[model samples]
Each structure stands twice: as C-alpha cells, then as structure tokens.
Target: MSNPFSYPTTPHVRKHGPAGYREWENYRPWLRDEFDFRCVYCLCREKWGRRRSSWVVEHLVPREKAQHLALEYSNLVYACSSCNSAKSAKWVPDPCQHAYGQLVYVTNDGKIHAKNADGRKFIRTLALDEDDLTNYREMWLHILQSWKKHEPERYRQCMSFPDNLPDLTQKIPPNNTKPEGANNCCYQQRKQNKLPEIYG
Candidate 1:
C-alpha cells in the first residue's frame, strides 16, 4: 500500500520478570481486536481456513533492532506460527549497499508486497509461497473478490462488522454438513480457536 504508522510502543507494562507474560497478555487482545485475528501477511481469516495460520504475534521488524518496540501495537501483527518463526528477528533481508526507500512497515497502509531482497527472502525463508500458504491466501483473496463481485450489499455488511472474518469464523454452524474436505487443516484450526462459536 502506502506509508503507514509504526507500531505503538508500550513502556509502562513491559518492565521485566514474570510481568513479561503480562505484557503479552496486555497486547494480544488489543492487537487481535485491531487486526481482527487475521494473519496480516496473508490475511488468513477465521472464516477462511487456518491451515496457514501462525496464530501468533509478528513484529514488523526483527525483535532485536526494535526490542523496545516489542509491545508497540503498530509493529505487531497476528500471524501464522510459521510466519513468526520464519520472520525470526530478521524483518528485512540483505540490502544492496545503496538500496533506497524505507523498509516495509505493517501499518494501516501496509500492503503484502515484498519489494526488496530482505522482504523477498523473508517470504522464501518462511515458505510463504508454499502450496499450503498459497492456498489459504488465494482462498481469502477469493472471498474478498467474491464480496466485491456478486454480493456487493452483503460485502458492505461484512465490512461493517469490522472484524468480519474473525467474527464469522468464530460462529459455529449448527449442522454437521461441512464441505467434505472442509474438515481439513484450516477448519480444524478454526475449531481449535473456538471459531465455530464465533461464526457459522
């Protein structure tokens, strides 16, 4: 996308010791609410399958360079566990000595494009292009596209829900008639997260 704000810094609660867990707890809910529990990188929503879900917090930058920014809400993203580990502390990849432009930051305008080596490497390193990952991403894109196409009115309604995907995923269907293979990865993970309860 375009320029976006940096992650919000949290200096007050992340002191040290056992309180670190508290810091995680403090940030998780707010961040999850903000991103609506969707993995920012792939936009894997609960309504979508969770096969690609890391279901963990991701730092836009490596934690080392921006440790102080750990709890910053803007720096955080709901990501599949794989993305978090793949991202590992190396937010960007090797720079060509004279590369220009700012590193990609996931703020309001952060689009999921890898423009530089570091960015591309991160994707490859994390296997973001893997079959499974691509499937989830493509599925979500289809949902977004479908909304834009045939169901304009309902699409507006979905957007109106704010955390539409997450909310929808959380809702459980009353019947047991899932699409044959729907019981696979994504749906299984969604059920684990109590998603069926949130969306039907």
Candidate 2:
C-alpha cells in the first residue's frame, strides 16, 4: 500500500483555472479537485473527517499581504482548517513551484523531517512537527496500516476519492482562462469511468 501522507515528488501542476469569482469561497469546489481532495500542505484527505467543514480555501500569498492577488486562481490552494490557521499570513515555499516531497519526509513514527532551509521553513511555518500534529499523523498511520491489513474494504474507503467530487463542467466562473480544463475535471473523468478507485 502507498503512504497516503507522501507528498508529490514533483511540483504540482494546476489542472483547473476557474477565475473572476466575486468571493474566494466560490472557488472551494474547484480548489478541492485541484488539490485532489487533500490539504496541499499536510496531505490531509477529505476522507479523514467531516467533508465540508474540515476543509478551507487558503491563499498562497495571503489576503492581507496581497489584496490584489486575493482572487487570483493561481494563488489559491486547498487546506485543512488546522494547516490554514497555522499558516495564517505566513509565506512558505510555493507547492506549485516547489515539490514538497523533496523538501520533507515523514517517518513511520509520524515525525516530519526537513531536507534543507526551505524545507525547515515550510515545516516551521506550518508547525508541521508540533506534537499534536505529529501524534495525529502517527495515529492515522497505524490506523490505516491496521485497516489495510484486517479491513480491506475500510482501507479502500479511506484511500479512495470522496463521493462528492464537484462537476466543474457544470460550474461557470465569471471568467475562466482554461475553459477547456472543465472537460478534464475529476467529475468528467469519473463519468467516463476513467477515475481510479484508490489513489496512492
């Protein structure tokens, strides 16, 4: 089984680029799919808890720091409430431009380790190594390992995509630079039976 907490080996590439929404909250659905239903910073999945309330839309540049980019599609990311709050108004390396997998690694004990200066900054800024979160990761790792071993079905549920994937094709932003991206949204792929049941 793949480590669900494992970060991407390469920088994230944005798939959906919905733009010109009056409120940033309107981009929630798009951000959800864009980040694969996980917190971009912590890899916390929607499968872990209450779907809607547990997640939030985070600004990469922060609204107070750069009001001009507040509504920019490229500046938005999906994050869990914990990470969002911890990272409030602080800039770390851009996940889109920097591959976090290269910066940090998680041990079986659930402690996060940094590779260098940027990695250290990322972890420190988000308090990723704090006891509460470290223990949380450790607990989940054990739980998932057990589930995968004894409850295959449960493991599948935890590892699979949520049932409520948004249909970007049905949404219309005020202006979309990548209108063609709608066709490739998760909902569309799932509709065509191209979506995988489990993600590594």
Candidate 3:
C-alpha cells in the first residue's frame, strides 16, 4: 500500500498573507513542505527542472473558476511547469484524497496507470502518458533499483515514512529581498507558444 502521508489532504498550519503583492512568496515554503517538494501531478521537483521557478503554486481549483480561493491554502497545489500549464483551468481527481493506489499506479513498464475511469480521464487530461514522462520515470526506477542493491541504507532512508525521515536540510545564506519578476506571466507565455489554453 502507498503511504497516506506521501500526499497531503490537509492545509498547512503556516500563515500565508492574502493574495497580493508577493503573497505567494510567503506561502511557497508551506506548500513545499506540504507536498514534500514534489509536483502533485507528475511528482517532479524544482531540482528536476531547468529553473527553481519550474515548480509553482497551482490552484487546485483555478482562480478563474473560484476567485475567492485564489490564495486559499487548502486549494493550492505544488505543481511543475508542465503539469501546471496543462491543468490550467480543469478539474482532476484530487491527488490528496483520490490518489490511493488503485486510482493511480505505476506500471512495470514505467508508465502511470490510471486504473479507473476517473483515473483515465485525469491521465488523458494531463497527457501523463507522454514519452518524456515515461522515460523520466524509467530512469528514476533504474536509479532506485541500483540504490537498493548498492546502497541499502540510503534506499531505506529514502523509503522511510515522512515522520521518520531524516533531516536533509542544508543552510543557505538568507535573501529577504523579493525577486523583480511577476511569476504568473509564465502561463501567458506558455499559452502564446500554442500550448492548450485551459482558461479560455
């Protein structure tokens, strides 16, 4: 059985300012912690992307649909650029409550299997079967297999429960200054590049 704690259904306890200038900055850390730095859809991380901004605060229910929930912590999701762009304004099975093993499973072929009709719809909606994602999962599978064989201790640690997980934190110099970028413009760029427009 998949670990329940692997995905979150509850909102983080951290304080997040209302949606305004740089409000997401205050909530980013909380979302990161809630999702364990993985995309709710593809499980991708900023570390896997070309930029730290690759992962973003995607609204589970798009702000266009529910403007009131724009900054509602419970409605926020941590998603990678591709998944976020693909899921711009559509609804899918909530990864938190609906991501149990049967609904979404990884097959031996390193493909994501949406076991039910809803799962199939979700997969189709997000194009989760794309070759790049298949190959990405396969690569990670191989790496995991190698780790299990050659680095049992590390593998065990990686497989441990979230509460039992070790502290992998590292200190970095503080930067309280805000970045000069308007983060939301990336979605417009993606749409202009002929990516599917979900909001329209």
Candidate 4:
C-alpha cells in the first residue's frame, strides 16, 4: 500500500496549437499516457469514477495567472475534477518538484495523513482527506483486496501494471481470453492516438 514516488514521472509534453481549451483537449491522449490515465493528485481513473469528468486536463499554473502558457503542454496535468476544483487557482508545490509520497500517506482505511508541514498543507489545500475521497479510495482498496483473494493471477497482473485500477479495467484481459492485438487495449489505443471509449 506504500507507493514509492510522491508523483508519477512527468511525461514529455508535445507542443500544440495556440492557446485555447479545445487545443488542450486534443492533447488528452498524450497527457493520459504521461499521467498513466489517472488523476495526478488523487489517482482516480475516468473508467472507474462516478463521473466521466472525474479525470480532466488541469493547468498546474492557472490560465488566469499565466495566460501565455494557456496552451502550453508542459503545464498541463490530468487531474480528477474534484481535485482540480479544490485546487482552484492556488499555488502549491509542483508534484514534479515536490515529492508527494514523502509528504503524505493514505491509511489502510483511506484517510490521508500528512507526514510533515508541507504535506499537511498540501492535503488541507486539496482536501485530500475529505470523506468522499476517503470513501472512494476505501472502496478501491476493497476491490483490490477481493481481487487478490479470489483472482490471484488477475490480481498479480493488475498489481504489476503501473496504472493501478485503470490497468485492471482497461488493460488486463479476462482470465480466459485475449484481445485481438495480443496486447492490453490501452496500449493499442495509445498507439493509435485513440482515446478510451468514455472519451468518444
């Protein structure tokens, strides 16, 4: 349950068109790969979230503050809408610059505990320990526990994949069969620059 990196590795941001939300939407597929199709803050996936907008393209620096970089790919992050909204226009340590795992830990029951002051600030700023998020993470933990108990092989496959729950939902095939490409669906989709079914 202990994750090593505070933030996932930063993906290369490809340059895109001039400033606009539409232009950023085009970069979602690429950004998804960089973020492993999970929210940068909460690590939720659109496939498993209650809302389709659970994961979205967020600007690390608000467009209102830095209009010139509105379409700058490097500034973009795929975050759950709730986290993005909670973070609205506030400046915090950049995940890329600040180590998150060192600052906070999500307990077995899903409450997030800050390891230090900055971690506390980050958690408080984003409401990382809010009831809804805690409950959601607890549910995921139960699902994972169930998978580990009842479907060990599947659980291992899912656990081995870096994308966590989404890897289970989108990439790992069922025990009895394989997909057409002999690959995880997400990998093929990424290869084709195709967004997931939800995005369609």
Candidate 5:
C-alpha cells in the first residue's frame, strides 16, 4: 500500500543514519499516504510537533531483529506519539505479563507474522487488538465519510481544534510571519497548559 515515489530523503539520513532515520526518510510519506497520516494503532491524524517529536515510524520488530527485514514495507507502519514511545526499541512484549501468548503482526489479509515469540508477547501484553483502537478506526471511517459529504464546514471544524482563528486569520497581516514562529504552529501548547488566553 506504500507509494514508493513520494518519499523524501534527508541529507544526513541519505549519508550516515540510524535504521530509524533511514526507514523514516524513505518510508514515512509512503506509509502516511497509504494510511492517510492516521495513526496505524489509534487512527488519529498526526503532525510533526516539538517536545521530542511526535508521530514516530514504528517497526514491528525492533531494529536489531529487523536488520534483514528492514526494507520490508509491510513490516513498517506509522504509530502515534504515545504508542510508538511506549514500545521503544522493543521487538515484542513481555509474555509473562500477559496471557494468550502474543498476537502476530498480520498483513492486510490477516496472516500471522512475527519476528519472535517476544513480539507476540508484546502484542498480547499491549492488547494490540484493543477495542479502543478499533473504535478509533471506526471513528476515522465516519470522519472520512462525513468529510466527503460536507467539505467546507468539515474543513473549518478540522482546522479549528488544535488550531484556531488567530493562527490562520486574515488579520495576521501581509509579510508578517506567525507571531510565535513554526514551533508554535498549533495552539496545542495553550490547550495543554490550559492557559487563560485559550480557555478563558
């Protein structure tokens, strides 16, 4: 489902880079397009944010185990900030903590595939087939359907939360850049801080 062409390579990553960096350079846009920039796990739209960077490129098998299979498109996917971070460098789950062994990474057709038993355990431990995430998938499905029905209003709403009137308003002025610059692209900071300017 990956579109091989749209991927971009960073200069540093093009030379000497970690597997994560290389995989992200060549694989991110492809996966983003394939999955519509939605989290492969939670099904939420993602943006590149500061604070250690969000929306990480997740590998089913930790890089060490994936050396031979690193380029396998099916083995790579996009994960949300929390999910990817929580899974840091792990190839699989701790089975002793969860029953039912581990759920193998299945392709779109739902075939069992895994690099090791630990991977299976990781899946099981995390409840990778979580009902919450499934519900999120359905939520994204509804959003897609709704977007097609009404573009203008939906687009406005989508541009509202996480963003706001001031950020992109015409009143911002010509030749004037964002008051706080790129890192402040979203109002997430205000929202996160529960600032009076945003909440009040």
Candidate 6:
C-alpha cells in the first residue's frame, strides 16, 4: 500500500498564479487546490476533520515581515492551524523551492527524521516532531493501514480528494499570470476524468 504520509520528491511548481485579491482569505480556495488539500508543512489532509475550521491560508513569508506579499498568490500556502500557529513569524525553507521528501522522512513509528540542517530547522520551526504531532501521525498511520487492509472502500475515501474540489474557472482574480492553470485545477481534472482516485 502507498504511504499517505510520503512527501513530494520534487519541489512544488506553482500551477496557479492568481493575483490582486485584497484579502488573503479570498485565496483559500486556490491554495487548497494548489497544495492538494493538505498542509504544506505537515501533510494533514482535509478529510481528517472539518475543512474550513481546521485548514488555513498561510503566508510563506509572514505578513508582519512582508506586508506587500500578504495577498500575493505566490507567497501563499495551505497549512493546518497547528502548523501555522507554530510557524508564526518564523522562516523555514520554501515548500515551492524545496522538495520536503528529500529533506525529511516520516518513519513507520510516526517519528519525523531530518536529513540535513534545513530539514532540522523545518521540523523545529513547525514543531513537527513534538509528542502531540507524533501521536497524531501514529494514530492516522494505523487507522489508514487498517482501513486499507480491512475496508478498502473506506481507505479509498480517506486517500481520495475531497468531494468539493474548487472550480477555479469560475473565479476571476484581478490578474492571473497563469490563466492556463485553471484548466488543470483538480475540479477540471476530475471533470475530464483525469484525476487519480487515490494520491500517494
């Protein structure tokens, strides 16, 4: 079975470049699709809990530090509330520029191990190795494993994309640098039957 906790092997390339949203909150839907409905830092999925309440639109560079980029699409990321709070005003490697899978690894025991200094800092900054997070990861790992083994349908539901994929085509940002990306959004892919049922 595919490990749901595995991180991306390559740095994320921006698929959407929406701009001119006055409030960063307006970018939540875009960020959700861009990051595959998970926390960019910790890999927490939207399926795990209440979506709107649990997830947040995070700034790659904190607003306090870069006020100009507060609404910039490139500077936005999708993160869980816990990771966002832990990373408040702190700098770590950019997820768009770094392949986290190369920097860190999540073991079967639910412990996160860093492969280098950057990874170490990333984990520390986000408190990714804390007891609470480890316990959370371990619990999910076991649940997913059991579901995959005994209840394949439930496992597919947990591993699959959320039902309400945002329709990016209807959204009109003031300026979209990559207008073509809208066609590749998860909603569009699902419409075309191009989206995979389960993402590893």
For candidate 6, write residues 1-200 as lDDT tens digits. Answer: 78778889999999999999899998998999999999999998998884225888999899999999899988899999989999999997788888999889998878999999988988999999999888888888899999999999999999999999999999989999999999899999999999999997
**Per-residue lDDT of candidate 5, residues 1-200 (tens digit):** 22111112211111111133334446554444344354554334543232224776677676777686665544666667666766666653222222212334433322234446654555554445555544444444455446646774554344223332122222222232222332232333354553232110
lDDT of 3 by residue, 162-194 (tens): 232112122111321222212212332343563
Q: How displaced is residue 59 in candidate 1, in Å?
A: 4.9
Off by over 4 Å in 6: 50-53
Looking at model 1, report the run of 10 residues with the lowest lDDT sum.
10-19
lDDT of 2 by residue, 59-178 (tens): 999999999999999999999988898899999778899999999999889899998888999999998999987887898889989999999999999999999999999999999988
Query: Scored by CA lDDT, what does every candidate get?
Result: 0.45, 0.89, 0.55, 0.61, 0.42, 0.90
Provide the global lDDT of candidate 4 against the true structure.
0.61
Cα lDDT for residue 77, candidate 1: 56
For residue 8, give model 3's deviation from the true position in Å: 8.7
Rank candidates, TM-score, best first.
6, 2, 4, 3, 1, 5
**Model 1 segments beyond 4 Å from truth?**
1-21, 34-37, 46-49, 59-76, 89-114, 157-200
The TM-score values for the models, in the order shown, are: 0.46, 0.95, 0.63, 0.68, 0.37, 0.96
Clashing pairs in 4: 6-101
Instruction: Give the clash count for each candidate.
Output: 20, 0, 0, 1, 4, 0
Best by TM-score: 6
Better of 3 and 5 by TM-score: 3
lDDT of 4 by residue, 125-147 (tens): 88888888888778767776687
- Residue 163 alpha-carbon offset, candidate 4, angstroms: 12
Question: Model 5: clashing residue pairs?
Answer: 92-118, 92-119, 93-122, 102-120
Q: By lDDT, rank the candidates, best first.
A: 6, 2, 4, 3, 1, 5
Worst 10 residues of 2 by lDDT: 44-53
Per-residue error for 90 in candidate 1, Å, reads 4.4
